[model samples]
Target: MTTPGWWAMALCEAVNDKTPLAVAFAGEELVLFRNAEGQAFALEDRCPHRRVPLALGRVVAAGLQCGYHGWTFDGASGRCTQIPNLRTNEPVPPRYAARAFPVSEGNGFVHVWLGEGVPDIDLPTDDYRPVGQQFTGSTIVNMSHEQYLAAMLDGPECLLNFAHVRMTDFFLGDVRKEHGRLVLERGAVWTTQILPSNFVVDYPLIVRTEVPVQGGSIRVDLLSEDETPLISLAIASGANRRGTTSLCWRGFVHAEVPAKAPLRWRTARVWHKAPFTVNSLIDGSAVAALLEAPSRDLHAARPPRLIPVSAVV
Candidate 1:
């Protein structure tokens, strides 16, 4: 269901105006402004009369006015109301309306649900952790946001599995460092799956983190390991920087595990900014195997040292 490319959230600078709702769009994210009005009028970025970006204009008198020729457009109906050159007595001209879309905003960002037709999709605004400190932006993907959720559920193996992911030309390499390791690559797909229980927790958490300066990467996920969940939950900022935009993916999961009266906490973010690819390969279904892996897997006072969180997830 992934239409193409990756544009799952909001734009970086769309939320500058807190009181006056702003307009922003990119094929997938045609959301309206979010100001005191708590109002979002979804619409095509094109101008029906002259095709100027209505987003470049400002909101006026319950609608938006295009600056190109002083043509004003209604937010809900995409109608052109006043053309300065025309007389007031003249009725509104035909074929002068923009395409208005349906949009909603919450969690400090706006969202557009893109498709040929409108369906019964409702946005949920609860129990979600913020990126860094706030909601960055919002978007309406041409495909299903649920698919974005599904990607995380499957883990990165789909892209790693030899039977699954492929590209024009690829290479899978196995190198032996002081410790155990294996690396596989084909095109842009690079993955490393480690095994451990650093991801499971005994208490509620904001995704404890760390970035060790080493050749590897470590992440402690509070949610599922497959679907490569790092998408829907991670703080996206500088990920695809080499591309037109950069994304920083951050995922979060909170649950109660068996911990001591007060469990000690250590994170493995050290590998976050490392070279190549890095992530833990965890099969939690083997509880007996995991329980024997490390007490860090458990919340109670069981072990002295623990593996990174990403390894255990």
Candidate 2:
């Protein structure tokens, strides 16, 4: 499966001098390590010989060494440099190299390019600081990657559905049954304003970036109310036998609920080919925009001119 857009794989601090870090993103297991010079490198976690996880080994002056046979690989090039047990005259095969990935660090996060060919856009360094309290957690949801994205883009409308109201009320504190206005903008960014019936000055503005992943999954950066990083989520299907969605929260200000729990939704209700209402055009159009150009050159594509529409509940 081909993944579209740049993915924020891990926080910059995830890789340090002590040891290599292993991470799974877009169905690929990668190991991140810092060389002796403190430069970061990402390589396929498996060692070609004996298939031992390289992450389990120590970071040597040469590169990452396999724990099984003490074979060392070049951190940047992924080329095998040494085999401890090889004969004095024996030559290492040319194919003994691990797959390497392009990595960049900025904005307190590490970004990995998972797509084929060259990266068209630089790693995003946009600020996403939280305005209030921050909370971070991960949860597993029973749904496909596409199904998970559909549920997220469905937004508050899905929360107001008769089948979902009981659950929504628990999280949102009796939000009025209303439709929010969605505005799609350039650079694949969009915003939604949700006004609840009870709160006069508490309308929440949700801003989201659509970062598509392989296997129809998505990684999104979400902000609520003026650059407040509410959630940075990586949504994928079958990450385990059950689908998994990992999230980090910042500036989440729901006073009624002291701590947020993993919220589950029936995928069958959220996954639909047709937009339930005109307001849902954002979801369909967002998917269309992603499909139109699966290349890394999405930012250079023509800007979509969509007329903002209001959907009444």
Candidate 3:
């Protein structure tokens, strides 16, 4: 089963150099590099010849030159262009090609499509600022891509839930304080919300993108109101001996930590059939409705309409 969306593979600045950078997505290893023309390309990391990682090689005039035996593959088509050991008239077989993936650069991110055939949905072009500033952090989590999406979709409402908020003060600051209305907008390109007014410092507009990775994991991107990148996170499934969840936060806010902190309270476990609170149910249902609509019609509008949750207390 393939998820429908553009998954961000790496930051634009990270792949600006000629060296091939290896990245893992959806369980497959891919090497990213820039050609002589400064265009980015992603190809299967393994060379068809000796099974050596193409990333271990260097980018040459023909494309990525394997360091093992001077085998060169085209960056765009992943076709084997040269083999130093081959005779002058020896014809290379058509099968000698590295699998290539479609890559596009936008919003300071290099995105790749993992689904089959041509991409029907357009790449995200939010004009967001490049990452690497202001509260930027990332950590791998033990959860599936679908679980993370459902959790984030209902996150605001879950945070606002009276019982859950009271029980978990560690996650949400202080719920006793009165908060303003939470506004949600669903549109052609994105779904966003305005954080509650009350707080010492509030990140007003929260723009989030949940991208599905190959191995059922997820890569989440969080942006601020002005579309400034905040956090780039990758959540993947793994074994937990204690049967609990974990969260590793790194930033100015939560720098200090303990050696053996309890992971259960820190991380919220996302289950497939987990029960939702009243507030979250409402929020998740609305989000589902918006997602079910036609994508073309959603993109045709100038700006998305903001719908406030009236029933939330």
Candidate 4:
């Protein structure tokens, strides 16, 4: 189940020059590390000899050194640079190498290219632009990647929450395609607002969700009734071991606050606390109760990943 695109594997800060970070995405195990010059790289976790995980190795001046047999591999090319106990006359075999993937870093994430050739599109985080102090977190949810995505659309409320805001069932509009993603919007209101016995006139807030058509990168926004942005989040998700899904997110509260916001919301902003949270524990019952809404269009309209011609070259 390999998805051909730039998948956010880990937070950029999590991968450093001192240690190798192991991550699994789309069922591919990869070891991430930085070179002496601080350039990030990713390689197949298994070493060619003994099949030991390269992640167990250490970062050396030359490159990543295998823990078992002292085999060193170059970060850029994943070619074995040196072998222990080799005579000066004997050269390292050019064929000895680990599978390497292209790496890109931006918007607080380390993205790895999982396609056949050069990346033909912008990175999943290209549109991410955080304003103030950003809150971030990482976790593995006990759900399959496909199901996780389905739940994101079917019931985002079950997966995450916005402080002082209550998401409503009223759909703003039908799901639509926008810039290679499926976008949905729903009505929302302040948690402190009292509902009238009769039907309310209009919602005071809005919750917008944008999910990519192919990859697992998702963007969520909380906006005022007039579409003023209040909070924005970027969530990177992918498959992990044992039918679980890996998730990492970065988000921030906007400077502008709604006039109708509660005192707690105002205090949270002044104290610089995160205005939203990505749930580490999902509710199974809530997920089961959610009707398959916009996700139906998402699954049906999603196109297959196409290998660009450059990959063959």
Best by TM-score: 4
Ranking by TM-score: 4, 2, 3, 1
- In TM-score terms, candidate 4 sits at 0.93
**Candidate 3 residue spans exceeding 4 A from truth:** 3-5, 125-313
The C-alpha TM-scores of every prediction are 0.43, 0.54, 0.50, 0.93
Model 4 scores a C-alpha lDDT of 0.84
lDDT of each: 0.33, 0.46, 0.45, 0.84
lDDT of 3: 0.45
Q: Quote the lDDT for 198 in model 4.
A: 27
Error at 106, model 3, angstroms? 1.1
The sequence of per-residue lDDT tens digits that candidate 1 reaches over residues 1-313 is 2111112234334532232233322222232543345455655666677877766766666467666776777666667777777876997865677775555554433444443344224332222344432213222222222221222222332211211111212112221122111211212221121222233232111121111111112122321212122212332211111112222233332332213211111121222221112122323342222222111212122122212111000
Q: What order do candidates take by lDDT, descending?
A: 4, 2, 3, 1
List of clashing residue pairs for candidate 4: none
- Which 10-residue window of candidate 3 scores lowest in summed lDDT? 174-183
User: Candidate 4, residues 232-264: lDDT per residue as tens digits?
Assistant: 999998888898989999998888888877898
